[model samples]
Target: MCDTKHCTKNNNNSRNNNKNNVKFIIREATKQDCPSLKQLIIGLAKYESRSLETLPNIEQLEEYGFADQLAKRLFRTVVAQLDGGDGDNNELIGYALYYRNYTPSQGKGMYMEDLYVDSEYRGCGVGRALVAQVAKQCVDAECTSMEWLCYGWNTSSLDFYKNLGAVDIQESLECHKFGISGDDKLAQLANKTVDQQSIKYKIRTGVRDDCPAVREMILKFTVDVKMNLNKVVTLDQLRDDGFGDDKDSRQYRLLVVQLDDSSELIGFAIYYNDYSLNDGKGLWLDTLYVKPQYRRSGVGRLLMSRVASEAIADRCHTVCWGCYAWNRRAIDFYEQFGAINYSLVYDLRLFAIDGPALKQLADCALQ
Candidate 1:
């Protein structure tokens, strides 16, 4: 017969140990949790060693948590509450804040705004649980993919994100504010100051006649860049091929960037609606390039702003584009304009299969 007393004592010890272990529950943040949320934010900021120049006070927290319409519409904050078990006082342990960031080219993708865990909960599964929650939220919102940025110095975060299949786009060069700041003072001077006479810009729908010039500009801009221009065709060819006798080809629209005074083309964008299995309806910035001399003269910004407005007018869910990883300037410019990088296309290739046998082999390899 088994020793009942020993077995009972062991079971009791196991239950006691389980009770002492950290346990947490995650739920949607309520307005009442604003104080706890604020504390958590402050703790996170302090832990990250950020300057308190923009720290949120109690009043600001109220405005942000309960009153700000824009903030509410843009993000959803979920809190993780640690329960000591047996109905003890629950404390806010961590948070995951995220919002919908759509990629026009890729369909409906989302990006995480912020994900932070308390220092005490660092080694626990709290962070992973928060990320998992955010991902589920993205899927529920019908997002095709999710992305976020991790600091380069934070190797732990980088490794965690990579483990979660996140790709870093630091390799893309983002040339930004070209003429506005830094050594590009000349580019900045191109824009008219408040006292100076403002230069007007003209925007119009591109036509077939503008194809040759636009294509030439694209070729010049991408001279040494590693980009696939297969779908980037001349305006005339696009209209002819896309809307030709066959009604099955993809549909596209073109916008031409021009100077109001000279009516000369500086840049153009080719875009189309993406209706794929993963994404519903998104806009792809197939090509956007301006003359080097005309850059930082408000030409790029004007074109991008107009494109965003046009995308909104067309009821597009999102707009998507890609830039080289080393292009910090371009990345900053895009981010300032509210465009976020939610996905990275890697190792893009262009190929032509000559024979049916080769095509079959390629398909098999893909599988």
Candidate 2:
């Protein structure tokens, strides 16, 4: 957080709904601003050519984001609004929504998920002001980095970020370098017939008996990522986390792909429902992994296909996942599927607070 004294400011050349110039005040979002913030979100989707069905309603946004007594808050938003306006039309011209994302490589950092400015508000300094404030907040929070995905084809924004010194997320390529597929395209991929002469594989839901296999695969995945399991999460705990019958615990769905003639599972994808105030009924792809020997033989693709097919069948608005910046092969594979690689110019980041910091936070009291 920039010193509150330094953060809030008014933009001189701002635009409002009336097309009349208005002073834009950039500051922390308040509870009453949820409606305008939601509108900005929808406007962003439309401008970016995405269906509005993907976003949540204003009431949902308010409850999740602004409910005052929640023990732990999940997200925060900052808004750029007309400082003064008559009636209830105090238009919020822009906003930025963000939260923490954790990755082993970097400690706690900021992930700006949405930053949108009304059409008329572009060119004004509202967007830059919002981001600059967030960047300062990232530093104040002791985060190693702040990251967000940029539209790959938005050259103007790409150049802007390049001037800001952002680097590509996947290849470390700079500035000019960069979804889950849409439901229809995913359906097209899933429904296509495979060649009879090619390697054959089948995907099926994981069962209790398959827990050991899944556990072993997870271990392999950990090693592949060049990280240690640390035994903090044991095989039994992993099994219970997934196969447990408790309704209150998070429920995970696992899809496995294996050869036709054998029972050996070559690939697997683990996903579950991820509902947010902004993204309603989405699918979170936890892990998609294929054995090294079986990769590129269509096992990974088959697993992803099943995941996407199930997502569409279950009415999920989107599927979200992440990849290591160094994994160029996996990056390319996902690219072929038209998965939006956010911020082709700079590798977006995942930030986390864990281990000792997690314990400290749990024990900390309000000052």
Candidate 3:
């Protein structure tokens, strides 16, 4: 959480001299800030030329992000406000919204859903302060990385984030997908069930007892993809962090496919709820892997279908994930289920900070 008392503000001579010595501080947003936040969200939409038809109403925003009845808050919000302003008249210049995401290779991470600064306040370090606060919070919570998306055409933002040490992952990978899982589309995919005669497997929610298998599959998947697994990733961490006492507070949800005959775990998927200013709520499929023999056997499709169902059940409107450009088969698989490759359509790029870069950013925030 972004504790207000400890939140920092930029007050260097350069910032103090900018635009009539404008002063600002970044702190966690409260329910009272929803209205301003919504306005900023709309402003961002207009800046991006995106439709506001899908924007959440103020009441929905409050409930989803600030509801008192929620077991765990859906997302964290921070606002950059003009400092020392009159009481409730303080002007909010920017905001950042983020949530938790987990991967086997990155034990825990933060996904920034929105980072917007009012146009008038751009170039005053308000955006930088908001992101620095989020980065600090990530480090405080022991998260391993922070990730977000950037429009390819937004060279300014791309440069701004790059200066913060964030890496454009799209340069190394192919693209990311936002699967529009409407009810009709979800039904069509789920209806394409696997061929039971060829492979006897059942998909079910995973439990702590299955952590070992999940860990094994995760290592195998990393190896198969020729990617390095995090040295700190561990089975105990998966079981403890993912199956904690407060089920709602778990980092990620698991679904595993097991052989009905031999009772072997052949495939698994790890997805978690995520939110964006534009997309509202969605599911991010961090990992979906099946054994080599199970490729083209409908196992991946069945797993994806379940993911779609889970999204609907959770009232999420989208399913998101990334794929390597060279993985033609995986790309075809996701496309068949209505997943739009945003890299092709919108030229969107994914950015992330981890390892030494993450440490440096977080350390800078603390100072």
lDDT of each: 0.54, 0.63, 0.81
Residue lDDT tens for model 3, 1-367: 2223333334431123244466776678999999988899899999999999988889878988998865546788988887655665478889999988898876888989889999987876677777877888898889989999889999999999998889888886654655655567766766677676588889999989999988988898888677777554798899977899887668889999999888689999998988877777878898999999887888898999898888888888778887888888888888888878877788888999987777666654423
Better of 2 and 3 by TM-score: 3
The TM-score measured for candidate 2 stands at 0.56
| lDDT-sorted candidate list, best first | 3, 2, 1
Off by over 4 Å in 3: 1-20, 70-72, 85-89, 364-367
Assess every candidate by TM-score: 0.52, 0.56, 0.92
Residue-wise lDDT of candidate 2 within 233-337, one digit each (tens)?
Answer: 455655665667764342367788777998888878877655443445557676788988777666776677778788888876667777765778878988777
Error of 1 at 314 (Å): 22
lDDT of 1 by residue, 1-367 (tens): 1122211112211111132255666667777887887778778667656655656565655544455554223346777777556657578889876555432233344455567888876755566556656666655554456655554556787777655445454533331111111112212322323211375667688876776677677667666364445434444554564345554332456788877778589888766543211122345565678888777777777676566666556555556665665776777867665454543322221111112322222221100
**Residue 206's lDDT in candidate 3:** 94
TM-score sort, best first: 3, 2, 1
- In model 2, the worst 10-residue window by lDDT is 358-367
